[model samples]
Target: MAKPGVRPLTGWLFVAPCALVFAVFTLWPMLFNGWLAFQDYFIAERVAAWNDFANFVTLYKSATFRLSITNSLLMLLTVPIIQAGALGLALLVHRKLPGIAFFRATFYLPVVITVSIAAIVWRYVFHYDGMLNWLLTAIGVFEPGHGPQWLDQHVPALIAVMLFAFWKNVGYYMVLYLVGLAAIPRELTEAAVLDGAGPRARFIHITLPMLAPVIVLCTLLSTIAALKTFQEVLTLTGGSGETVTALYFVYNMAFSGFNFGAAGAAALLFTLVCLAVALVQVRVMGRHNPFRRPA
Candidate 1:
């Protein structure tokens, strides 16, 4: 007899193809990136040689690397903003209100749009003479000929990137929250209502505690996405603003600067940071999960 928890041969067969692809593509690339981190590879030279801590030294000393890391961390500050927007929107639509489906689809428009294409559209809108400036001017928020340079400057550029990130991901997380809200037994809320618990009180005491796992998952996804932001910065600011994120640093080093070894090193560090965040999330949320064992 087979073990109680083990799946039969059919299940293993179903998973084999995807496992093969993962081994070939994802695992191979990750292993290569790890190997490359410890080697010196110049574009002119076809052969890579063993490098001893040189890549790490270069990565640590590079001011651009520091700035990119800072920008990526700064972008992480928007996770709360995204949570607030997505959660509120999810709560609004989780119930079957009039035209709820339309509102959900409209909110999800940004996620469906291609990143490159959306970046271009946003770049046009955020330009000095774009729709945003026009609206502000019309509303008398800006003096004539005093439109803010949303992309040309450092602070405004970062702000624009954060806003775009929030907009693009809000609906995605909202859907996740909606799923969580659905899984919560309706009777619990009904009982609370019958017991004279107000809507706000019910939400504060019952809804939130039940959705803990989903909130953790959303936070982990948003934080990692913010850390790996690249395409938005590329098209939005021509990849030349204070908004250069960590992933862009890797791209610039490998392709533009022809320093694949150093890029690999930085990539490894970024991977470590991502892994740490995920592990912490799992540890924290596992406590609330029914499947988790008592501590």
Candidate 2:
């Protein structure tokens, strides 16, 4: 008989197919990207003799690459804004207010909407002569005939895309916070209250500590998502802004310019940067995880 807590040969056999698929699809591509970083591999020409990091050198020398890095870094700053807003929404909805379920559903509704649809809807809302400018005009902020170029300009386009992304994703994060809040032990809060602790004190000391795991998970996930921001930027700005991100640059390099090797190198570098950020986050916050004892 198989030893308890150990997998049998049959179980290993069962997992072999999944392991093979993962290795082929995910592992091989990653390895290939690393290889491509060293040489020039064109679409029609295919892979060439290794150039010893020439592609990487070229990537670093490009002005577009620098702009892409700055754009990605700036976009990442929105994560905390989103997480804090979501947490506030969670705290509000987690209360025993009337129609709480309805409110919770309303909060999550945006996440269910397709990104394409959201982008299109936002397109109209932020149009040069659209409802936003109309409201601004009505309030005398601007003349009826005047409106900001929401998508035509670089900065405004970036801001508009970020705003839409935040609105669409905040609900999903709010739901995650709600789940975390619900799982927190009610007795702990009651005990704090009994000890003459008010809401603010209890939240600061007890609630946040208990919710540390959830916060870490959300932070890491949001960081990755922000790093990989492509669809919204593509749909909203079409990679035309001065704020084109790293992924968009990769997309353009590979598809538009047909420079497969350089794109692959850029992608590999982006992956390394993302991994570094994730490691830094873990180093900073990993000790606070509830599942691990604090040193």
Candidate 3:
């Protein structure tokens, strides 16, 4: 056996490796990036000069940056769409039915696929003469060879990105809801049924209340993912001004434009926006938290 003090030390020893990696890879880089936001970083000469907030000023005045922000905000509309669709899917799959496991696996397949690969496949679907238009024509929604340019126009391109986001992420949220539904005590639902509560009544009263935490969690996650959307836009439009997002703007600034300082500022601003949204969500959703202790 070990001494009482030795056990605590050993626990810390086990945690030290992971803690060190987080400090080196995550903490240090974030700190450095924050520092870079305030300085004009010269890549070749390894020099950095204080820029006196010029980068942020420039970003504020930039039409492209403003458009990117608008597109990112527009992506927020998909959060509800994804969440509702996922909940519907989870409810559909939660029943005892033949071949339910296969259906669950099939729905979740998209979550495991590489995002870049999936976006590339979607690029083809959004192409002017792609399957989407072909189907639309077949359905008589569009005349032959007269479909709107999906990837060229701003509104359509943004809509395409939103569609891709929904298809790629709904299954993941569905799994989350499945787990939440599983954890709900069947006793409550069964008792409600015995009390003459119909399916809709039980779901509205018991099920929704119990699943509040999970709803909050999925909503928060979906919101963050929508705000940080980058890969879909990158692959679909290649940072075309129409579908460029804030994160993609940061990428273009750092890698393509070689303006690390501006990129750093944009990144910091975006991070603060994400943090603000998360805080607001927690505050608003925490009110519905069934497990919270009374004040």
Candidate 4:
């Protein structure tokens, strides 16, 4: 039998390493990045001079930054599409049927593939003479070799990016919904059935309410992921065709252009936007959170 305080101290000792690592790697970098946002950082001299908020002012006046922000916001359109598709897929595969596991694995295969590889594959699919154009031509949507340049135009490129996002992420969300569905007590649905509720009514009244917390969680995750869209744009369009996202812009500013100060400012602004969106989502979705105590 140890002393009363000994166990608590031992627990804290176990936690100390993780805490130190987080402080060093996460907290320190965030603080340094915030500080760097207000300075003119010279890479060659390894010196930083105070810039009097010029970085922020320049980013605000940049048309490319504005367009990047707009494109990032536009990516939010994929959230609802992905969520709805995931839920539908979850419902379809949540049964005791033969070959169900194969279908589930097939859907989720995309989620495990490397993003660069997946994006490269999709780049081919969207190429002018790609399979998609071939299929569309076969269906009379376009003439052979006259297909739209999917990665060269603005709207088409954005749509292609959204499609890629949906394809890559929907399966992951489907797994989440499947777990949520499995956790739901079958008695509730049975009771609703006994009360003469039909399939649509049962889903509306029982399934939706029971899955509220999962729905909220998935929605928040999807929204944040959409707003942080980067790899798809980078690999697919290479920041061309007006498909540059906020994160991609920051990457270019920092790594490609060597404008670290402006990049830091853009990163901080993007962080704030994500934080605001998350807060708003929590406020709106808090009621559905199962962990919330009733007032």
Best by lDDT: 4
Which tens-of-lDDT digit does each residue in 83-188 have in candidate 2?
9989999999999978999999988899999888788888898899888889989999888787788888878888887888799889989988999999999999
- Candidate 4 global lDDT: 0.93
Query: How far does residue 247 in candidate 2 sit from its true spot (Å)?
Result: 0.5
The TM-score obtained by model 1 is: 0.88
lDDT of 3 by residue, 1-295 (tens): 7786687679789999999999999999899999999999999999999998999998999888889888888999999999999999999999999999999999999999998899888888988999899999999999999997888899888999899999999999999999999999989988998999998998899888988889988998899899999988887788763899999999999999999999999989888888887777767776764446779
Instruction: Count clashing pairs, candidate 2.
Output: 0
Give model 4's TM-score versus the native structure.
Answer: 0.93
Score every model by TM-score.
Answer: 0.88, 0.90, 0.92, 0.93
Candidate 3 accuracy as lDDT:
0.91
**What stretches of model 1 exceed 4 Å from their correct place?**
1-15, 43-45, 136-142, 283-286, 289-295
What local lDDT score does residue 196 receive in model 3, on the 0 to 100 scale? Answer: 100
Clashing pairs counted in every model? 0, 0, 0, 0
Which lDDT value does model 2 have at 281?
80
**What CA RMSD would you report for each candidate?**
2.9, 2.6, 2.6, 2.2
Error (Å) of candidate 4 at residue 78 is: 0.8
Candidate 2 lDDT for residue 283: 78
Q: Go through the candidates in order and give each one's C-alpha lDDT.
A: 0.87, 0.86, 0.91, 0.93
Clashing pairs in 3: none
How does residue 231 of candidate 1 score in lDDT?
83
Off by over 4 Å in 2: 1-11, 45-47, 137-146, 289-295
Question: Which candidate ranks first by TM-score, i.e. highest?
Answer: 4
